[model samples]
Target: MPELPEVEVIRRGLAPGLLGRRILRLVIGEKRLRRESSPEKFQEWLPGRVILDLERRGKYLLFRLEGGVTLLLHLGMTGRLLLGPGPSPPRPHVHLVLELEGGLDLAFQDVRRFGQALVFPPGAEPDPLAQVGREPFSREVTPEWLAQEARARSRTIKNFLMDGRVLAGIGNIYASEILFAARLHPGMPAGRLSPADWGRVLKETRRILNAAIAKGGTTVSDYLNSRGETGLFQLELSVYGREGEPCRRCGRAVARISQGGRSTFFCPRCQKKK
Candidate 1:
């Protein structure tokens, strides 16, 4: 799945070309995505509307169009949004294509068909936004806030960090990295964390997320920028995907464990359980 940083990278990459362009037409594919609005709905709300702005909420991309209509996209595991000149050759797994006024085409391709494309009319709030919590970079997010939210919660710290309802845009990859940086064990119960512990987690979360965004996100598999470029952050990974490799800090073998069915990588010596 494309997490916060990956989605943010896409938003920044596409914003320059997408803003102010009018949607000339909608080319719908025969195959349907996991969550998509009807072709009639898309055609009715999208064509002839100019793209006013591009925004990202959690892992969802929001294309604000003229007359207050919003185009929402969620790039599931293997989804890619590629932009190129029109009259381009047909590619496989392209489910939606928006023909722009400048002869440019914005195509959404997902081999697994798990992505989402939805259109929301004026005054209608996107349903997916309701599920997204505060962004990690928000000033409102503080150690005190995290402590309050995790109060009485028995879930593991890793699971707490991965919960989109509490902190938006965090997934398995960043969760492991953030916990590793904070020197906190993934299996530690959420309620057991002190305010100082939460402070370290919050600081490292912002640091790692900003670094990932700067590096254009981690491309472990199918992630690509609008220009079809792979991310460089994977080369800087510390623990994730480095199972049994020596830890960069402690020189101890990096460990991998399963939490909530997702692999979590950390240093056992550094992130000792309390």
Candidate 2:
């Protein structure tokens, strides 16, 4: 699935083309996504509304439309949002296509069919974003705040960071990179981290996430930008996918371990266990 950085890249790519464009029609696929709005509801609420702005919360994309309606999209694993001239190519799993006024087709293609599309009315809070925590770069996510929330949690530090409810937009890939950058072991307990350790974690988290966004996010299998380009961040990964490979900081080989069913990669010598 696309994380925060990947989704942000998509938002930036699509905003200019989508903004000020009114939806002339919505074409629903025969196959349904994980969650989808009814065809009648889509037709009634979507057409004639102009896209005013595009916003991203966690991994969800919000298309602010005229008249207080918001078009919500979640590009689940193997999903791609592409902007193309005229009608899109006849693809196998194109779930939703928005025919815009200026001869543009906003296509939502999901090979795995795990994506979600919904139309939210004015003043309505999206359920997927309801429990999302603060942005990593936000001022509200200080070391003190992270320590406070982690004080009672016995989960591993990696798991804690990956939890969307605690810190939105981080997934397996970035969690490992952040931990590696902070020089912390993934198996360390969240509650055991000191405030100073939390400080390092927070700092590295922001730095890594920002760098990932600049590189267009990590393409670890099924992630692509709105222009169908693979991410460059994976080329610069420190430890996430370099299992058994030599560590950049230390001479020792990078190690891989499974936690909560997700693979974590780090340098055993550099990221000391406490």
Candidate 3:
């Protein structure tokens, strides 16, 4: 799945092509996308309207429409947004296509078919996008919020970070990276942290997330910018996916462990249990 940074990158990429354009046609090829939010309704609300702007909350993408409605898209996994000339022979899994007034069509393709395209009217919110806890990139998500959520939580730091209810948008890749940078073992309980530890974790989380956004997010698989280009952040990864490799900071072998059924990589010496 595309994380926050990757989703943000796609949002920025689509803004230039989408905003100010009128939709001439709307096509929804896939059915069974989040209940009651179908392609027919999407086309009905979208074809004649203009795209006001685009925004992202956590892993969800929102397109503010002319009718005060919002089009919410969750790129669950293997989903991609592509823009190009019309009728580019529908690639496999090209489930939804929006033909713009300029004869250009925006195609959303998903190989795994796990992604969903939903149409939400004004104040008619969807749960998956609404349940996220915070805007990790905004001032709203402060160190105080992080510290408060960490208090009395016995879950592993990695698991805690992945919980969107506690912290928004820090996914598997960033969780490992943040834990490595904070020098906290991924398996450590969140409540064990002192004020100083919370400070380190919060600071490093922001630092790492910002750096990843700057580098255009990690390209572990199938994630692409608007123009279908792979991201470059994978090359900058220090711990995640480098298991058994030499740690950049400690030279000890990076270890991989399963946390909540997800693979987490960390430097043993640098992020050892405290």
Top-scoring candidate (TM-score): 1
For residues 175-251, what per-residue lDDT tens digits would candidate 1 score against the true structure?
Answer: 99999999999999999999899999999999999998898888986888887777555638889999999999999
Model 2 regions more than 4 Å off:
231-235
Give the Cα error of residue 229 in candidate 1, in Å. 2.0
lDDT for model 3 comes to: 0.81
lDDT of 2 by residue, 1-274 (tens): 7888889888988888899999998888999999999888889889999999999988889999999998899998888998888688888899889999989998899999888999988888777788888888888999999988888677999999999988989998899999998999999999899888999999999888888788777787687788777745564889978998999987799999999999999999999999
- List model 3 lDDT by residue over 1-274, tens digit each: 7887788878877898999888788777744543337655776677788888988888888888887888788887888899888865667777788898787788888877788788877777666765887877677766677777878576888898999877777889989988999999999988777788888888898888787777777788678777777745564888888989999997999999999999999987898798
- TM-scores across all candidates? 0.98, 0.97, 0.94
Order candidates by TM-score, high to low.
1, 2, 3
- What are the lDDT figures for the candidates, one per model? 0.93, 0.89, 0.81
Residue 105, candidate 2: alpha-carbon lDDT:
93
Question: lDDT, candidate 1, residue 192?
Answer: 93
Candidate 3 wrong stretches, greater than 4 Å: 34-36, 231-234
State model 1's lDDT: 0.93
**Pick by lDDT: 2 or 3, better one:** 2
Which candidate number has the best lDDT? 1
Model 3 steric clash total = 0
